[model samples]
Target: MAFLPTTREEMLQQGYEQVDFVYVSGDAYVDHPSFGCAIITRVLQAYGYSCAILAQPDWHNDDEFTQFGEPRLGFLVSAGNIDSMVNHYSVNKRRRDKDYYSDEGVMGKRPDRPTIVYTQILKRLYPHKPVMIGGIEASLRRLSHYDYWDDKVRRSILMDSQADLLMYGMGENTIVEVADALASGLEAKDICYIRGTVWKTKSIEYVSDYIMLPSYEEVCKDKRTYAKSFHIQHENIDAIAAKVLVEPYDGWYVVQNQPPLPLTQEEMDFTYSLPYERTYHPKYKYIPAIEEVQFSIVSNRGCFGSCAFCAITHHQGRVISTRSKESIVEEAKRITEMPNFKGYIHDVGGPTANFSREACDKQREFGACKSRECLFPKPCNNLIVDHSRYLDILRAVRELPRVKKVFIRSGIRYDYLMYDKNDEFFDELVQHHISGQLKVAPEHISAEVLDKMGKPRKELYLKFVEKFKQKNEQFHKDQYIVPYLMSSHPGCDLNGAIELACYLKKIHHTPKQVQDFYPTPGTPATCMYYTGLDPKTMKPVYVARTHEEKAMQRALMQFTYPQNYDLVYKALKTAGRMDLVGNGPKCLIPYQKPGHFPSRRDQGKRYGQKPYAKKGNERKGMKKR
Candidate 1:
């Protein structure tokens, strides 16, 4: 169980003249199961294919890429675990200074779009070698979609990267099929019929029984057409029920086959049981990305809670897949034996912790519903709301020989928990799982905003909160719920933000951080961000696109902070909520004199200036930037 060869010397030491595949990635090599590059490379190795890794190769030239030389089969490329653009920029489109995926958390180690950059570089260097791109970046951009950073529609990445194929979704199964085909002497263009892949085709004369989406021209020209096209794509996400989808360009069509079938319990067990180093490569002293997942165990894959802002539904699909309880506990025992074992397992969950089985029995035979959601609007009657299996696994891990505590850090769907008639799992969760705080996403309290987010209504979250409080009290514990709040989602305006701020005031809860709606590609909310229409219904939606408005919405969430006083005051005044602006008990803030909202003392050093301390204390703490 050695790490994959990264240099030519290491490849030669392994007694190989040339590897079968050279996997390029934007992230530092962390051969943990949590990283997609690790999974794909390890799976290929299991199938008797020699592979080498080119982790975060310098994109300035082909010098670094030549380390692995050429492969016998082809090169598999991914933009790390996260999309490179999202990794490099903030929600405000500002270039972020820290990248967790790089050595020492440095930024600019990889270019903005590594899938495109790396593939284009490979094509120029190798010319005829097969190139395939996958990972969150390629999976989301496999179709023609909106580009938030560019502020325009972009064509499929397959067309731009000149890569022969783009594998969307979890690529364990898709990679094997494509790799086998390539090994059998099939060219990239000829390997078109595999599921969970998008490929370029000059003619669809042989294609049959596929839905032809609106051409790239139509979606770019008309917002309504774009909305309609996005909705059509959303409806066909399930593998069992979905048909082949084709998006037309001027000359060629980008065809997406149905998603790969969800993995079975046996397959899920085999995937996690593979030998992995479970840490970053020894070359680097430290990588910030490996801290959280070093001791974590992934119990499941895929999510059914189809939030509009999340791309999990698009990439992992809504179908839930789980590992057997024995498989999970076995991993926990191994974690206990690590040299740095701390008597604690950081996490025992995946996309959603409580989802340990299929959404319903029908989901296995048929697929998740095409027209409606399983939890949003309301829980489906057919929805199976049980957490017993997950509870059993948690109990088993806790009883392991050297493990002292097991915690669940990944999100738990509170709405789904609230819908269950049985409260045993809920009670035990409050007692055992949480580490003094349970984090959940309510997103927003406004009904309109929640609707646009495809989240449950506010009433459901409130009920869950009350139940959580009751459970904590019953166990004689002091626990709190750290609700994940977002601002300026597609349907949110000044009034919506104000409504959420008022709710926070009522509950005396101010979030430590608020997530501004980021419109990355391949999400229903992103489609709304670009077209100003809800892709689900094609109705007009209010979007806070202006910088001032988006700031106001964000500030309203943290209205208690002195730094946000000015923005919050303006938001309240513009919304004509003057009644709530006075010095009453229910007032958000005291009225300040006109043009003198926040004093210099109140502004403090938050505005990039040295604080003016009191005259006597000035000499006590005087530091210059």
Candidate 2:
């Protein structure tokens, strides 16, 4: 199986007069199953659709888009695996210097909003061609969303891009349906009844049994309405029982069909079994993104741990799907045979590593509970917290020939692990999977903040930490637990920040980096950030919106650093906790350090310099200025 044709010449050489679908992607062509572009195109190929890759095309001109002339069927567009804006900039909106997905890790290969930009270019170049958008950027923004960069509510990407159809969530199922529909000569707009798709309609007369969200005008005018709209969207994400959602904007309505059903284990296995070249196209000497996932194997998809800040629930759904152990081991064997085989497998995990099964049997039939969470506050009684199957898969992978270490880099939900009564998997994880350190996200220590973030209580995390340490001691391994911390989350006020700092000090752990809360679209936390109201309860919530306040919260997380001295001191003072500014061991900073630079409190004035002293001495030695 050769790599997909990336150029028109290659397509012609492959004996195709015109490809069925010209897939435009923001990433360089990497024919690996881990890349969504590879998965979709390969799936289409398996079904006998001729697809060619048009990756990282020039956004400024239509010439690049028309390189393949026009697809016989339609154009499939995606902003790669990640959202283009996130790929291009940091949380602080600073332009990133490197794009791991691009050829040779170069930056600026694609436009800021590649999905919209590329679709617009296609529409302009071939006015009547069907443009279909999918992937992370389109999936999460399938409805009205708050744009962090723009600091305002923006219409759905489908609306902005004028894409004929928007395939949300995992596109394997949706894309096939779309292709079949288009192949049968049904127009794109008329192919609206398919599951896991969003399409525009001029009239709502045809929409029935669907929940109507607040109009775009209403949501934009009233924060409460926006919160209500988000709550409705969040509740009905299940495939079993979710109703179709309709969001109106001006005269047109964006109708989101029910989510696609969770893929069966056999389907998952077959998807990964596709013939992928498993590396970048030969044109590129290197692609940094492949390095991270080349040795890794994804054994599962979906997550039951619906964290508030995470968009997985909205995008991947909460249903867990796992491939057969045989399928995974087969993949691992192929990985060991690679030319650059290093006798190590990077990871065999997914959205949540230990979530290898559905949360409960009812989830598959009755769907997830609308009002309650599966693992927040505490695990639901119906939660099936088991790790035996996951452990079995890991053991099989470890037993593979030429495999030295199989680390679980994809994070495990510690609270979910704690829910399991069995300790065999936990012990094995400590003894085997961990490299030097195991990372877990105990986002915040404050119970209130954790509740707001939809994370487990602080005590749950503390218990897990204690158990992890005990297992490490029993195994005689000096592995450390690196806790991932977040700052300035919706409910994290100055007090919450101080409490978190105190906890970190008690644990004697200084994180190398701290993540300030970013309110990206399609998350509950983002809703709170935008509306200052918890959609679930409609209660007022505190949000750290100002740059100064967010900075202070971040600095408090790393108060031990000398450079953070001033910010910590100011935060302590502002919070009416100046008591924490003394030289006491309990204090975050010393009163003497008035600024980031050194100073002497005994002087009762500025230290390290005297105004005009150097100039005065120089004047004494020379003529006056």
Candidate 3:
């Protein structure tokens, strides 16, 4: 009688259609409607679920790496923009000029990204699907960590990326409870009973307790010896069973472990009030600067600045929850109704972005209270400070009417903006929101690797750069803030890089850039930048930790980019520091090697490098010397 339309009345009429769920990410970074994993896969397809992202995953393209539309069921993985626990550590050499320029990999096997061949080409083309994995480089390699640039003990990234599970931290309620338990069909060994997750069945290893970082190196050298070392408790122990060996010619098993239960500020403010729209509406669909650009809103997460070469104090737990400011002006009015709404709102402070909502008075008791971030892992507490409801939600989304200016552009804990009684939110963030230059990290000038990267006191970043150059010359406006400095971390040397080229030759200020310190995966200074030695002064230091000392610490963070100022002023006057340059001050950084600035002449034809070439060897600029 009804000539057509009857696949159960076309599935009883358009309601449940949650497709494949594929995700993937090796790292391309912010481009689609401006990414945060394409706004967390468009907040899991607006909570109905049918996601599909895939940035750098080619895995020898079998019809373009499987997942042919629907029935694929599972697979998330994610380098989540390189931090896959700092890509296993080479410290990407002295943190090489912003966003990891290279420690190992400028190119070579990208086949898309996050390799073990993106999990052996998604387990030889989805033989049974359900892969999972999470970000912050698979949650600091999910288990059995502590590499410190490979000094040892590493295995449990679900046993090196064979991955059938691993969600780890900051995954907003474990990604909507693993997409409502695989849309209620379950199985991948019953989604490993879910917690902060980590599973494996046909060989055994089901970890659930989740925090873990120091998996060795004498428990990453103490914290009551790594919480009585990676526990196997058994005492009042709720659940346990051991004797494992997943491979040494694959045989033994009996593993079953359960322990993780720490997330709560109402589960971190219900993962910062996830409805996560930040624009792209007409019923939704707009992630494209290639994916995302300057419209991220967090308000706060975890970061007590315990630098020990940061792993965000082993992934977001030094507790600091915050979200309120009327849920950040309704996520900045959903990033100003999208479709490229750039009234500038790139990032709104968190993880040390002015210690939001005062880190709920000491969450994980790291030697209990007595602030200034438990002493110089920096954020210097003149204590008691507040963002006055995050500067009244950045002055009510810059007085909205199509919001145009509101960038506290991320990293700015300049010792809590020189906290002399919270200097008027650091003088109204250097007179109304700085966009030109303010990045601040002060990783090291080396008070012995800022007390092993817990930082501060290298004479307090020159008294917060002479109180931010006398509050920008009392607003005479010469505005510039830039000091993210980190140089060869683990107790640095060359007397800590010539005492950081003699404190930029007595703070006249020469740093066009300098982050030289690489050791990424599971930090604590990647075991002192890959064991050049300094397990607390076991001597012998000056390690750039190779790759030619991180290319001379990436040509030593351009000591003032006037084309590497005469070879960074002849390597800071041959590491002698020429009595810190002159005249009233602010500009005297020459260790030579800055050559042809303007981003190496806009990376001259992308490294064929020909901006009026004649200097030879890739057009090496400046230096008539």
Candidate 4:
């Protein structure tokens, strides 16, 4: 149970302090104020919508958290960085399974029961109050999904979360739009006609047409692939236009990515013209709306990398867009003026922080192929890569003092960093901007996978790692690389897994943790996971999403004992990775008796397919298996 209560009555009973709409995520070096669920709560309160904002609402207890002060307005959800679609479940389960569907967090072991993160308490206390679900989690779940993590297709999230409605896409604009719509004498059923909304009604249901986006699965493998498929230059309308009927389950149609309307120079300038001190102190709150940790300004939107497993191209499209430096600087000044203001600016970056000017490889007179690598189908010849201007803005930020520190914590593209190795300012960024450790997504190590994903050569990753490792050593502090590794991307199979494990051994360091592949709501990889064939190449690849397969890929990343030993041993045996079994740098796979292994999971259990256990982990003296 959560330390906090899940019920509205429980919340009202307790004399809690003022409810906070936006709070900081408790991760170290992650001080940015979250903009999802909490942000909406703040906005609602300001408009006299009568809601409470609880920062980092305890997931363990929904009752207490929901009960606090004001009358209940529906709950809005967004997990940040990760779209709610994939973040709903544990990493491995959410990403790899095809048959996997999202639920409203776990209710009980009715066996195969569906649940959401905070539905129980909401159901228990506010049964009469409306609870609207939105953000990536609900948006992706609005329709049936082919979860790569589970290896089989699953039902839509709407059917599972049991919330009144769901609003998708970046909800900053949508949440206010939705709240205002609901507050104005509009019925929930009729609200479906609103753009970027999902709701239900009697007799007939309504769902606004989904902007044709690429498959979520493909983005998991490489965002560039998604970009190639749907971006304007490649503009493969047939693939994106191909309809996957929602009749089997009613809600919304499959993703349909429209042409990316690149923000014009004037529009970019206009965004810069908006008030940068983006703070919202609702009427219900006692304090100001701004937070100390996260004073953020989006420098640019969308990506030029067009990785196979990303959705930027499918959603925001390929052409990069930006806000002016003056607007961002002014916002920083406004934040500084707050009574509670501290000389701290957590982050000032966006989707691939390095690319300031839009278009990948922007310098060439003759354009590259016009395929959408980030989407699906294909990338275009007109792809451009431009990052020169972004570097200047970052330097300008460094000179600003009221802003104590500027962070590029939003997952940097090392490929961009490598292009201009001599850019001294970038090296400074590596030293100052990083919060002890820099996180870069070197998604995979295989050449084949890299090419398919439209990523730079694997050699480039090696070169950058070597260069950065040297730089970090020179810096003489704890600053190191927090590499993001993805298992079971579109082109990855046993070979890819083995290769990754071997690379870890060669690097002489083991990853403290890792993430498994998640096909998300709208990406190309989901289709490949479902059909076991990459749409682009029509190549057959074994989708390793079974509990055993997922475990095999995971074991190489850690030294967790017994629970992981069996899986690791099997993975090594299957991959012909016997050398890892003996006492070597990366050897965790030595043969051991079943119960002697060390892992968070029990013996014979694997992630995504852990067998039914009668008791919870907290239960004392209970036998595991």
- The candidate maximizing TM-score is 2
lDDT per residue as tens, model 1, 1-625: 8898888888899989999999999999999999999999999999988899999998996789887778999999999999888999999989999999999999988998999999999999998999999999999998889999999999999998999999999989889999999999999889989999999989999999999999999999999999999888988888898989999998999999999999999988988999998988899989999899999999998999999999998999899999999999999988898999899899999999889898999998999999889997898889999999999999999999998888999999998888889999998888888899999999999999999999999998898989899988899999999999999899999999999999999999898888999998878999999999988777899889899999999998888887888898889889988777767888887665344657665454333355666776453233542
Off by over 4 Å in 2: 594-625
lDDT of 4 by residue, 165-227 (tens): 665554445556667766675644445544445554432333234333444454445534433
TM-score of 1: 0.95
For model 2, how does the per-residue alpha-carbon lDDT over 389-461 read when each residue is reduced to its tens digit? 9999999999988999999999999988888899999999999999999999999999999989999888888
TM-score for each model? 0.95, 0.95, 0.32, 0.61
User: Model-by-model lDDT, in order?
Assistant: 0.90, 0.90, 0.54, 0.52
RMSD of 4: 12.3
| lDDT for position 530 in model 4 | 57
lDDT of 4 at 286: 24
Give the 10-residue window scoring lowest on summed lDDT in candidate 4.
22-31
RMSD for all candidates, in order, please. 6.5, 4.8, 24.7, 12.3
Between which residue pairs do clashes occur in model 1? none
C-alpha displacement of 243 in model 2, angstroms?
0.4
Query: Cα deviation of 183 in candidate 4 (Å)?
Result: 7.3
Error of 4 at 234 (Å): 13
